[model samples]
Target: MNKPTSIRMCAASLLAGLSLLLSGCFITPGKFTSELVLSQDESFTFTYEGEIFFLGLSSLAQMGAANEEFTPQECYDEDTFEDRECTEEEIAEQRAAWDAGAETRAAEAKKKAEEMSVMMGGIDPSDPEASEELRRILLRHHGWDRVEDKGNGVFDVSYSISGKLTHDFMFPVIEDVPMTNPFVQMIIRDDKVVRINAPGFSAQEGDNPMGGMAGLAGLAALGEGASGGNGADEMPDLPKIEGTFSIVTQGSMKIRANNTDEGPNPTPTGEILTWDISPRTQNAPTALIAFGQ
Candidate 1:
C-alpha cells in the first residue's frame, strides 16, 4: 500500500479511539442528550421507588406523591367475609389520612428542591443573564413570564396556561406526567440544563395509567377543587410530576402532540434524522435537542 494511504488509516483509528475515551471520561452522548429532557419541562420530582436511568448516572434523587387517596375500595370486593360499609367517622378518618399523606409528599418535594438547589451550586434558573436562551424560549412560546432565584439552580417558573378539554364526562389528563413538572426550576452549568425536578402535582386529567373514575375519584376526595383541577389548578399553580427524559444538543428533534381527541392515538410522525451532520452554507453549528421513544 502507499505510505500516505497507510498513514491516513492510522489517523482514522486514532481519532476513533480518542472519541471513545472522551465519552467515558466525561459523559456519553446518550447521557448528555437525555439531559435535554431536563430542560424540556424543568422539574423531575416523582416517586423514586423504582430505578431511574438518565443523566448518565443510574439515579440522581427521587420524588414522592401524596398517597391521600388510599381509600381501600378493593378491600370489600369479595364479601364472603363479614365486611360492613365504612361508617361516616371511618370515611372522615380515611380522608384525613390521605390529606396527611399529601402534605408529607409536598414537604418531601420541597426538601428535594432545596437539596437540588444546593446540588446545582446555586445557579439561578431565572437569571436573564444566566440561562438567557431558555428564558427566551419560555417567554416566546409558553408565556412563562420569568424565573426567581431560590438560591440554587431551582427557580419558580411563572406562566399562565388556559385550555379546556371537551368531554361529556369530567375526566382528567396528564396536566404533568407522573415524573416531570411544568413549573420546573432548571439549573444550567457549562451551558447545559440540569437538576430537573419539581413539586408533587396536585391534580391531572384524562389519560393517567391509574385511569378511569378511580383516579379521578381519588383526586376529588382531596376537596372541592383538587379533583378536576380548578382554574387555579392551571399550569403554574399545581405541583408537577417529573419524567424520565434526556437531551441531545442539536442531536435530533421530534414533534408530537396528544391525540386523545381522535378516536385513537396516532404514531408520532415527523422528519426523522438518523445521522449527525449539518450543511455549512448558513454558518451555523448544531444544537442539542431532546427526544423520546
Candidate 2:
C-alpha cells in the first residue's frame, strides 16, 4: 500500500519546515487533552483524548476549486517580449474544466473530512472500553499502553515506550520522524546519567497509522484561505480554529526543560500541566517532557 502524499510530506517535512507553519493551515478547530505518568521504577504511561473539528473542510474544498481554476498569463510566444492573455472563451473553458476537476476533488475531500470527523468525535476518553481501533492507534503510534478514555475529551493513558538518553540535555535525534508527529516517546540513559519519560498526543495519530488528512498535499492549496495563510488577501475568510490541550503528568519530570526548545507553555500545577493548543494547520502539535537525574 503506497502511502498518501500528505503522509509522506508529514513524515518528511513536518518537523523541519511545516511544523513551524501549522497554525496558518486549514486544520479544523478542536481540543487535545492528555495525561502522562512516569513511575518511580523508570517506566512511563500516557493517555490522550480530544476532538478535531472538520467544519473548515468545506472551505478547503473551495480553495481547491480556486487553485484548479487559476491560470497564469503565459509567454506563449517564447521568442516575443509580449505576454499572451487568455481569451474569454479560453478562460471559460478553463473555468469549466477546473470546476469539473474540482467537483471530484471536492467530493473526495468532503468524504474524507466527514469520515475523519466521525472518527475523531467518537473518542470518549472517559470510556474504559473505548474503540479498540483507537487503542491500537495510541499503542502503535505513541507506544502507549493501558489506554483509557477519560471522558469529556480527557484520557487516562500511559506510555510504555522507553529508551536511554546520551546526555542530560541531549535531545535524541531520531531521523525521519517529525518531533511533532503526534506520538509519545521516552528516553533513559542507562549509564546512570539520567532517565526521561514522556507521553503526549491528545489526538491519536490524526486519521491513520501513516498520517491523517493533514498529510494530503492535494489539499495544500486549500489552506490559502486560512488566516495569514498564502493568498489570504484574495481568499475568502476562513473560520478560526478553536481548541486547547490540558496535560497532566505524574512522577518526577520537567517539560521542555534543558536546552531543547518547546511550544507554548501550559499551566503547571505541581505535576499537572495544561496548555492552550489550537488547531494545527501545517503540522501536528507536540510537547516535550523531560526528567532530571
Candidate 3:
C-alpha cells in the first residue's frame, strides 16, 4: 500500500482499539466560557455557554469504524520487513479474503451497536430520531436555557444555575444520561471546604476523552483525502478544544491550593482564577477554597 493508505490503516486500527476502551456515553466540552463563583457565606453560582458533544453518537466514532472497511492490505519484504509492492495475484487474494469476511464484520458491527444502545438507556445512536430525542431530554432540565442540535451529536447550549453550597454540585446533571464524566464538579467537604475541578475543559487525554479522539481523527485526515486531492475538502470537520474557565471567590474565603499559572489575581469582588483553555492545555483547572469558622 502507499503512504497515505498506510497512515489511514494505522489510524483506523488505533480508533478501533480506543472505541473498545471507551464507554457508550461521553459528554465533552467544546468551545465555551464557564465560570464559578463561591461566596464567603457558602452560596455559589455557575454558568456555561457553548458547545457540548456526545462522542459515542457522533460521526467521529462512526467514521473511525467505517474507515476500517476501506483499509487496503499491505505487503512487506520477507527478510527486510520493509514495505513492498504486492503481486497482482497477491492483491486478488487479499481482495477475496476481504470479501469473504464482509458478512462477519457486518454482523459484528450490528451486535456492537445493539450493545451500545442498551448501555445508553435504549437510545440508539444510529437511529434517525436519536438527536431530537436527546434535544428534548436536555430541554427538560432547569439550567438549559437553549439547546440547539447541531447534528452529529453536538449541541450548542446555554446553562446557568445558582444555589447555596449545602451539597455537592455538578454541571450537566442531565436526566436519563449515564454519569460517565462531568464537565465541572464542586465537592463540599465536611469541614466546609470546597474543591473544584473542570476536567472537560482541557485537551489532555485523561482529562477529556474527546481530546484523544480529536487527535486521532486529525491524524487520520492527513491521508489522501486531506493532503491535496479531489476529496481534500471533503474530510469531516473535527471537534475543536477551546474555552475559558474562571473561578471567583469572596475575599474572606481562604485559598488552600490551585493550579493556575499566575495563581489568584486580586479583584474588587475578591480573587479570580482563570484558565485559558486550548488544545495544548495539558492539565485541567482545579482549586480548593474554604470558608471562615
Q: Which candidate is the best by lDDT?
A: 3
Model 2 scores what on Cα lDDT? Answer: 0.38
**Per-residue CA lDDT of candidate 1, range 89-183, in tens?**
77778778777788777786566445433322342322345434333433464434444433212334443333211111111111211222121
lDDT at position 27, candidate 1: 13
- Model 3 vs. true fold: TM: 0.81
**lDDT (0 to 1) per candidate:** 0.27, 0.38, 0.74
Candidate 2 residue lDDT tens string, 1-293:
12233343433342223222232222332344444454444444444444422212333333332322354323245586544666777778767776678777778656644444343444332234434445455556545545554322223444333433332321112222223332334444443323332212222234442233333332343333222244445343333323333334444556554221243243342354444433343334444555443
User: By TM-score, who's the top model here?
Assistant: 3
Off by over 4 Å in 1: 1-75, 78-87, 119-293
Off by over 4 Å in 3: 4-8, 17-24, 67-96, 206-234
Cα miss at 206, model 3 (Å)?
4.3
**lDDT order of candidates, top first:** 3, 2, 1
Writing each residue's lDDT as its tens digit, candidate 3 over 1-293 gives 56566555555555654474346366777789999988877798899999887876677667545624544567889998878788889988888998899889899888877767765667888788988887887888898899999878789999899999889899878776666667788998888888998876666557444443444344444433334443344445546768899999885898899999999999987889999988788787899898654
- Residue 128 CA error for candidate 1 (Å)? 11
Worst 10 residues of 2 by lDDT: 169-178
Candidate 1, RMSD to the unseen true structure = 24.5
User: Candidate 2 at residue 44, lDDT?
Assistant: 46
Higher-scoring candidate on lDDT, 1 or 3: 3
